[model samples]
Target: MMAATKRIALGAVVTALIAGLAGCSGLGTGGAGSAPGAGKESAPGAEGNSPAAAPKGAVNLIGDGSTAFTGAQPELPRAKRLKPGQKPPQFVVFSWDGAGEDSQKLFSHFRAVAKKYDAKMTYFLSGVYLLPEEKKELYNPPQHAAGRSDIGFNDTEGIRQTLAELRAAWLDGNEIGTHFNGHFCGPDGGVGTWSVEEWKSEISQAKAFVKSWKTNTPALKGEGPLPFDYDKELIGARTPCLEGQKNMVAAARTMGFRYDSSGVGNQVWPTKKDGIWDLPLQLVPVPGRAFETLSMDYNFMFNQSGTTQGDPDKHEYWGNQMRDGLLQAFDRAYSGNRAPLIIGNHFESWNGGTYMRAIEETIKTVCTKRDVQCVSFRQLADWLDAQDPATLARLGTLKVGQKPKPGWTAFLAGTAPGKAAVGPVPARPADQPAGKGPDGSGD
Candidate 1:
C-alpha cells in the first residue's frame, strides 16, 4: 500500500511536472531496503527528508519552484591546485546509474559504504524514479510513446525509498547527476536516433522530474524536498547504452553540464568534447582475456556470462575476475601515470550478486590505500579545473601502463612526451561507438 498522503506547506500537487518531461537515467543497481546512515548530522526526519525539505515555510523556489534554492552545500572540500613536481593523487570514482533505493536499497547501501571508506561517489538519478508510475504519461519521451519506458516505473514505496536515499546521498557530499529518462537503448530509435533538440527536451524533462516531484507524488507532499537545489547540484551525467554520445554531448554542453561519462576511453587524463568533459568509461584489464573491457560491471558480466547468468559454479570466478580487472587498472594508474580511475556500476544483483561483492571487496582493498582518493565526478572535475592546463596536456601524453619516462616531476614538467613515450592515448579506444556500453551502464 502507498504511504498515507502527507500534507505540508507545499499545497496541492503543483502541475509543473506535468509539462513534457525532458530527461534521462543511466548506470544501474541492486540494493537492500534498509535506511543507511547518511554520514552527516541527521536531519529532523532522519528516516528520510528534513522538516525544511518542502515549502512548509517560505522557501525561495527556482524557476517554477519545482525545486527550492538552498544555501551552499556542506562538506564539499575546496579543490587544491597540484604543486609543481608533486605527483597527482590516484582518483577512483565509483558511480551509479538509475540510482534509486528499491527493495535492494543499494543506493543507501553504497552511500554508507562510501562513507565508511571516506569516499564520495556520483549517483545519476533517473527522473522517472521521482515521477510516480500512475503519472507516467506525462513523460512522453522522444521516439517512444507516452508512458512508455524501457526500465518500467516506480511505485509509491519505491519513490519514497529513492527520495530518502537521494536526500541522504546529497547531504553526505555525493553528486546527484542525471541518467535522463526512458532509457531507450538499441537500434530501434534508441538514443542514437535522437536529435540535439530531442536530447535537450530529454534533459529538460530530467530536471523537471527532480525539480517538481512533489506535484507528481501526492503522497510525498510533506515528505520534504530533496536536500539541495538539483539545478545547481547537477553538473554531469552518463548516457544509456552509451549510444548517442556525440549528440548528447552537443546538447549537454549547451545545457551547462560540465562533464559526460558516456563514452569508452583509455585510462588517461580526460579531454573535452563539445565543451563538456568527456569522462568516458575506461578499458581495464580482464583476467583470462586478451582484451580489456569497460570499467563497468555490465561489461564484465557481458564478457564473462555471454549476456547470460553463466554457470552458477563460476560466479565466484567471475566476481574475482572483475575484482582483479579493476585492481589491475587501479594499480597501473596508482603506480603509473597517476591519472584518475573511473569505475561504474549498477545496484542490481546480476549473476547472483557476484559483481557487488567484487566491487565491495575492491573498495576495501584500494579506497583506503595511501594517496588514493575515491571521489565523485564533480570533485574530480573541480580538481581538474584547478590544475595547470599544461600539466594536464602533458599528463595526457602518458599512455595506459606507461609511466613517466623519468618520473612524475620531470615527465609532467610542462614537457611533451617523446613520440614513442607518449604512445597511443591511454584508456581511449579509437573506434568506440555510442551503444557499446555494458548491459545497464555505459558502452
Candidate 2:
C-alpha cells in the first residue's frame, strides 16, 4: 500500500513514494456524470466541445494522417505585456497528467468545464494512451523492455475516443502537452536515472506515438486526424513522478521546449532554469493540518487516507480539505504577490471520486473571480515571455505570501528605493536554484 512506503521531504512538506500509482491504467466502463454547473452555457461565445469542427484553412495531413496542419488554432489568446505600474492578474493553471478518455470520460468532461468557465488548460497526454496494446512493442523506453509500460497501453476504442477529445481540445484553444510514455519511477531503470540522451529518446518516442497513431492503430486510420501538428503544439511536459528533472530540462531545452512542470517549488513567482521556465507544482495549505502538501490530489490522498480508496466515511471531508487547500493557495496569490498558481491533477476517480468534485468546485469558484485568468501552462509561458526582464526580476523578489510593500503602482513603476528602474535584468532565482519541494507520487 502507498501508506507503507517511505516518505521523501520536499522543503517543509513530506510526500510518499514517487511511483506512477495514481494514474494506474485501466479502461473502465461508464461516462462521467455531469459536473456541477454543467448545463450552464459557455461564457458568451466560447466554443463547446460539441464535435470536431473543420479547420479554418486547408487540412494538410502529416505522418500517416495521425495529425495535420490546421491553420492558426481558434480562440488562442494573445499575451500582452502589463502596462507600467499595473498589477498582475491572478493566473491559475489547471493541468492534467495521462490525459485520455476511458470509461470515466474525464477528458471530455473537463473540456466542458473549461469551456463553461471560459478557461484553457494543459493536457499532458501520455503517449501510451494512444498506442494500442498490441503495438506496445513500438515504444522503446530507455532502460526498459520495448513492450514494457508501467501504465500499460490502450485499446483501439480508447485510442479513438482520446483522439477525438485531443482534436476538440486543441480547437477550443486548450494546449496539448506531453506526459511522455511509460510511467516508470523508482531508482532502478526509472526516469530519475536515465541519461540526458536517453531522456531525449523517450521524448522523441512520445511525440512519435502521437504523430503516427493512425499507422499503429489500423482500425482508426479513417478517422479525422488531430487538428494541430503535434511537433509544434507540444512545447511543455510534466515528467511521470516528477523525477529526472535535471536531465529532463537539459534535454527538453535542446528540443525547443519552453517550460517544464516536473519539479516542486514554493508558491512564489517562477524563474527559468537552463533557458526553460521551471514552473513547478507548489506547496499549499492543507486546511487544518499542521503541515502543507503539494497542490495535487495524490499528495492530499497520501497524507489523508494514505491510500487511493480510503475510508468511505471520510470521503467528503478529504475532498473538502483538498478544495479548501487549493482555494487557500489561490487566495494568497490572488491577494498577495499575484504570482501564478500552477496546479496538477489526473483523470481518476480515487476515493469515491471526491477529488474530481473538489477540482470542479475549485474551477467554478476561482476561474469566475475578478482579475483571475485560468490559463494553460503554455499561455502562462507566453505571458511570461512578454514581460520585461527587470519587471519579472522585481516580481520574483516578493516572497511567498508577501505582497509589494509599496503597493503595485509605486512598486512596479520603478519608483521604490533600492529597486532597479526596469532596465537591466538581474539574476533570477532559477540561476541560484532553491530546494525543490517534494515530488508527488504517480502521474
Top candidate, metric lDDT: 2
Residues 1-443 of candidate 1 have per-residue lDDT tens digits of 00111111211211111111112222223333344333322111111111233433445666444466554455566677667777888888999877877666567778888888888889988888888879999898998899988777776667778888887787787889998988887667788789999999999999988988888888777776775777667789988767788888888888879999987677778988778788888777775454566788877776666543577877777788788778888987887778889988877777788988999999888888888888889888887877777777777777676677667776655544344244332442222222222343322
Question: Among these predicted structures, which one has the highest TM-score?
Answer: 2
Candidate 2: where are CA atoms >4 Å away?
1-55, 415-417, 420-443
lDDT of 1: 0.72
For each candidate, the alpha-carbon lDDT, in order, equals 0.72, 0.78
lDDT of 2 by residue, 1-443 (tens): 12123344554223322322233333333342222111321211112212244556779899789998867777775677777898988889999988888777788899999998988999999899888889999999999989998777888877888888898898898999998998887787878899999999999999999999989999888899998888888889998778789999899998879999988777889999889999998877776554566778887877777777788877887888788879888877787788899888888888998999999999999999888888888888888888888788888877666777767887787633465322222222212212222222211
Q: What is residue 94's positional error in candidate 1, in angstroms?
A: 0.7
User: Which residue pairs in candidate 2 collide?
Assistant: 10-438
